[model samples]
Target: MMYDQLKVLEKTIIDIKKKYQLVNDELNSLKQKPNTDPKELAALKTQLSNYRNEHDSAKKQLGDLDKRYQNLAEAHHMIGEEQDKLHKQLADLQRKNSELQQHNDQLKQQNHDIKQQNHDLQEKNQLAAERTQVVLKRLTRIDQMEG
Candidate 1:
């Protein structure tokens, strides 16, 4: 929208300048003429002055519009950079999360292996206790018989 406005202002300034030039040429021509009316010359001078003022105003407006456009462009570029940074951070976090998940799975497998080993050891301990009791009973029987 601002660009469109700038274009319009530029066109206006160009038109004003052309009109000013034409009036100036006509005034110069009248000055060279032997029979020129004072009223007409004065009117042309006034019109030329008005056109100059309008041209100046348009130029200032165009300058302001250009400044505003530059500011907006800078802001948009910064936002794009910030968005890229955020995406990179998100990717890094996702990669880290995946690594942690893999480590957790490894720990779970290790825990399961340890539990299985503990269960097997308990069964062996139980069998060993049973065998020890059987040997003690036999020893007692022999001792009583000898007595």
Candidate 2:
């Protein structure tokens, strides 16, 4: 976009320069014309004045355009800075999300280990209870036999 605007400004400047050059050539040609009538000279002077006015106007317009281009350049720079900041923010967010994912995986592994330990403890408790029950039955049979 900036390039496009610059091109337009360059073209405008070129056109103005061409117009000024043409006016200058015309004025030079009028000066060279020998023994020119007073009325003709006066007319030429009027034409010269008109050309000067046009040149001045073009110069003023060019100045205005230059100011506008400067403003646009500043705006473009600011937008570029904002884009860089946003890109950095996105990168930081991605890094943070990756860290969180790694933490989640670690927590999942710990949960799995705890569940296995709980299962092993439950099996051990069940085996101990079965052994105690079998011993109590044998003692009760022996006591009945003695009685």
Candidate 3:
């Protein structure tokens, strides 16, 4: 699960970098293009300004995603430690000469809850990835048309 999140985060970072570069290159090309139509030039400039804003937004999101990646890594490490502790506790409980049904059930429930949370996180991450891909595709289409 953490690995999937890492992949998604890395992909997002790459996409944002690509977008930034594409926008910068387009702006440079606009600068080099011969001045023939003032109206068209103004429109292109407006479009470039919007892309610049979007590029800045993507850059900010990339930074935020990096922080989230770090947070997820830390959470995974903590979850591992917690699982280890729970396993040890379960072992000790099993060694006791008493009914262990209730304790075992509680542990099982905790495990189930953790699994559910991880599943939900994975789904959300996947949805976010889908949305990012759609946006990237749209941007590529626009770039192609403009070029």
Model 1 poorest 10 in a row by lDDT:
1-10
lDDT of 2 by residue, 1-147 (tens): 887998898898889889989998988887788845889878888988999899899999989998988988899899999999999999999999999999999999999999999999999999999998999999999999999
- The lDDT of each candidate is 0.79, 0.91, 0.90
Give candidate 3 regions above 4 Å deviation: 84-147
Order the candidates by TM-score, highest first. 2, 1, 3
Clash pairs of candidate 1? none
For 31-136, candidate 1 gives per-residue lDDT tens digits of 6777477787688668667856865776676577668667766777798899999999999999999999999999999999999999999999999999999999
Give the top-scoring candidate (TM-score): 2
Better of 2 and 3 by TM-score: 2
**Residue clash pairs of candidate 3:** none
Pitting candidate 1 against candidate 3, the one with the higher lDDT is 3
Q: Candidate 2, overall lDDT?
A: 0.91
**Over the stretch 105-131, how does candidate 3's per-residue lDDT look in tens digits?**
888999999999999999999999999
